[model samples]
Target: MKNSKLLIIAAFFSIYFIWGSTYLFNKIAVTEIPPLFLGGIRFFTAGVLIMLIARFMKISLKLSKSQFINSVIAAFLFLVYGNGVFVWALKYVDSGFAALLASTQPLFVLFLLRLIDGQKMQRKSVIGVLLGVFGMYLLVSQKEISTSEGSVLGIFMILSCVLSWSYGSVFVSKADLPKNYLVSTGYQMLIAGFLLGVSSLIFKETWISPLSWSNKAQVSVTVLIIFGSIVAFTAFNYLLKVVSPEKVATSAYVNPVIALLLGWYLLDEQLTEQSVIASIILLTGVYFITSRKRIAKIKVTTKSQKI
Candidate 1:
């Protein structure tokens, strides 16, 4: 039990740190490689590698028809729209800014949960969502009272990314999938990778030879495949099984912070005073929305214990 707890802690650290650094590496990679192509190669390689690992672990990789369809939908929503668009938009925006914008995912998930499942909404959570929106408006539009066209477009794309991911998250919960989380994730990545490869061809993106890629780009892509996709995602899957969903969801908040710090330190990305204030506002709002359910769960557990 003690060793298991230690492993869980290690896994949490992996997801928190590795996932956060992915935004930075992705920024480096997309500078030279086309977004879809990069996404294709990254996910495809990671998917294949992880599937092999799953097999070695003796996890069943078979999918029923319904499970396959659900995986397709999830792949389309998560990798195609969610991650692909965000990666494309990184060309025009700062990585830290992109991470900050993407942090609104929890708020979007809250809204989607209410809309789709008719889940009761909390007034505080609604307020938090609005604050996040306002903070985003300030962050993205500060260049002009009305945001610069490029910034506006990038912000919009990131929001769409958030929405796609949020909806996918909800959908996957109810969808039939492989019993093993790693197997399910591997299948989703495989499908999304194929879709991304097709998109790269459609757009006529030049596939740079690996030898021609800068050392930095090569390293970035490698880390993205290994740490970001394989290790971090595996950590997330393990954490989800052992921890409460809300505890696992803390990544939504921690990732942006890690992203922001790494961007500022490594990439020398922008961190203007206004941007700092906006990040605080945005992250705080996200915290409220994400934590609300956890708090409720704690209360319920306490009451039941008393009974």
Candidate 2:
């Protein structure tokens, strides 16, 4: 159990760092590679690699018809559309800006949970949502919003991505997952990757130039695949098994900070005082909103068991 806890912590940090850095990496990759195509290829390669490993492990590839259908739906919402929006958004926004906008996902989830599960929104959650929105306002205040050539479209796309991802998370929790998360995730990735590839080909011009590989780009892609895709996801699954989903989901708050710092240092992106203030406000809001219910639940459970 101790080892497992350590592994989960490692996984949390891996996801937090690798995923945070992906926005910058995507920005760099798109400098030479087309957006949709790059996304499609990345997922496709990762999916195939995961599938191959599963095969070697002799994991059962079988899925019930219902599970198959659900997986396909998850792939569409989570991978194809969710990630698709991010890739599209990166074409217009700075990496740091994109990360900041994507951070609003927790707020979206809070609203969705309230509506769908009849979960009562605590006062703290409402306050948190407000703070998060205020943070967004601060973050976007300095940038000129323009649909034609700037962060405007990017912001919209990233918000859409957040919504899609939040919805996908709910679906995953509700759906009947296979006994093996690795198998289920592998299938979802494979199906999603294939669909994304096909969609990219139809919607955008594809490019893969051997000469386009810079040392940085190569390093970025490799890191994203290894740490971002495989290790982080594996850790996430492990954590989900042992920890509450709410705890695992806390990474949503931490990821933006890592992204901001990394973007500032590595990409020479500017971090304004407003950005700092906004981040604090948003994080505080998130803490209040997300933790209240969990804390309540824990207290109730303990009382009931003691009684």
Candidate 3:
């Protein structure tokens, strides 16, 4: 029991801090490596590592044909376009700003649910949507920030990626995914890694050899693969089984904050007053949406258990 409690705490820390730190690490590695190529190598290596771990744990590596297809689709949506392109955009945008922008995933997910499932929004959720929109406006409309050379394009691309990810989240909920989340994630990463490699080749990206990379880039990519992909992701899956989804979801709130701080401190990215206020509003909106979802989920669980 004591060890389980310690493990839970450690898992939460991994998802919150390690996952959060990935934004900064990705920015560093992407500086020296082409984004698609970097993502390809990172995810492929991570996928292999995860599969080994799964096998050691006696987890099944098998999946149905439909599960394989769905995993591929999910991989394309979540990693290839969603993550690879977002990292590509980091060349033009500050890591902190990108993190803030990416934090709007829940808002996009809420809207996507409405459109796809014909789900009605609750009052708090509606308020959250409004706040999220306003916060996004404040985030992007900063004259000094948006007018920079390619920042506008980067922001737009990142937003599109977020939409793709949000849609993937919804799709995965209803899709025939592998029963084991770790197995599912490993398959998605492996499939996405291959597709990203193809994309890199199609784009004719200059793939930097490990020997050619700077020490910083090498360290950054290593951290991204080992800590970011494997450790944090495994921690996330573990949390979903042991904790409330809402509690696990709180990592969303902390991730951007950690990114913002790390970017500002380590990368010397700009941290304007307006950005601070925008983050507050955006996270608040996310809190509203997630908290409501938590309540609804709890009620349903309680009712089902009673029956």
Candidate 4:
């Protein structure tokens, strides 16, 4: 039990730090790498590595036909479109700004899940979602107001990315995934990688290029594969085994904080007062929306047991 608790804490920090740093890495990578190619290489290599590791562990790789199809659908929605747009958006926006927008995903998830599951939306959850949306507006539009112009298309693309990811998350939760998390993730990554690679060929001209051995690009790609893909994912899987989903999901709130700090310190990105205020409001809103439901459920269960 103690070890499980320790693992959960480690997983939380890993997800928080690794995912936060990915925004910076993506920003640097897109400077020289094409967006689709960057995503393709990242996912493809990570998938291959994960598969090899699974094989070494003697894990079965076979999947039911339905599972395969579902994995592909989830991958297409989450990775191909979701991560694809993220990399593309990073080309236009600051990494900090992009992450801020992406962080609104929990709001989208809550709204969509309520609709699909036919779950009643609590008043607190609705207010939280509204506050979060307002916070997002403040963060994005503030920069536009100051600069007198902004990339409205870029904002839309990032929000689309968020929506795609939110849908994917809900779908994954509902889908009957393989019991082995590593195997499931490996298949999803492979499917997503293949689709992204094909999209790169069709939509992007520079799918493959002469390899450059620059230190910055090399470091960024290496960190993304090792820390972002492998370690963070493994940690997340472990976390789910040891902790409740609610606790693990708190990484949604923590990741943005890490992203903002890393962006400010390492990338020299400026955080306006509005951005700070928005972050707080958004996190608070998420807390209310996600936690209130759990709290209510617990109370009801306790009262029923007493009866």
Alpha carbon lDDT at 38, candidate 3: 95
State which candidate, 2 or 4, has the greater TM-score.
2
- Give the poorly placed runs of model 3, Cα more than 4 Å off: 1-16, 133-148, 235-253, 269-277, 293-307
Top-lDDT structure, candidate number: 3
Q: lDDT tens digits, residues 229-258, model 2? A: 666665655554454444455566667777
Measured against the true structure, the TM-scores of the candidates, in listed sequence, are 0.81, 0.84, 0.83, 0.83
RMSD of each: 5.7, 5.2, 4.7, 5.5
Alpha-carbon runs more than 4 Å astray in model 2:
1-4, 142-150, 209-211, 236-249, 295-307
lDDT by residue (1-307, candidate 4, tens digit) is 8986687678778877788888888888888888888888888888899999999999999999888987788787778998887888876677766776776776676666466654466677677667666776777676433211345677788889888876766566556556688888788778878888888899854854526646788789888887887778767655544433333445555566677778778867776787789788877866666555443332211221100
What root-mean-square deviation over C-alphas does model 1 reach?
5.7
Q: Model 1, range 126-179, lDDT digits (tens) per residue?
A: 766776777766666665223334887887888889788777665654556676
lDDT of 2 at 151: 72
| Model 2 backbone overlap count | 0
- Flag regions of model 4 displaced more than 4 Å: 1-8, 127-131, 134-138, 141-150, 208-210, 234-252, 272-277, 295-307
Go through the candidates in order and give the clash count of each.
0, 0, 0, 0
Q: What's the lDDT for residue 204 in model 3?
A: 100
Worst 10 residues of 1 by lDDT: 298-307
lDDT, candidate 3, 159-257, per-residue tens: 999888767666665566688878987988898889999999999999878999999998999999999888887676566556543345456556776
In candidate 1, position 68 carries an lDDT of 91
Looking at model 4, residue 223 earns an lDDT score of 89
lDDT of 2: 0.69
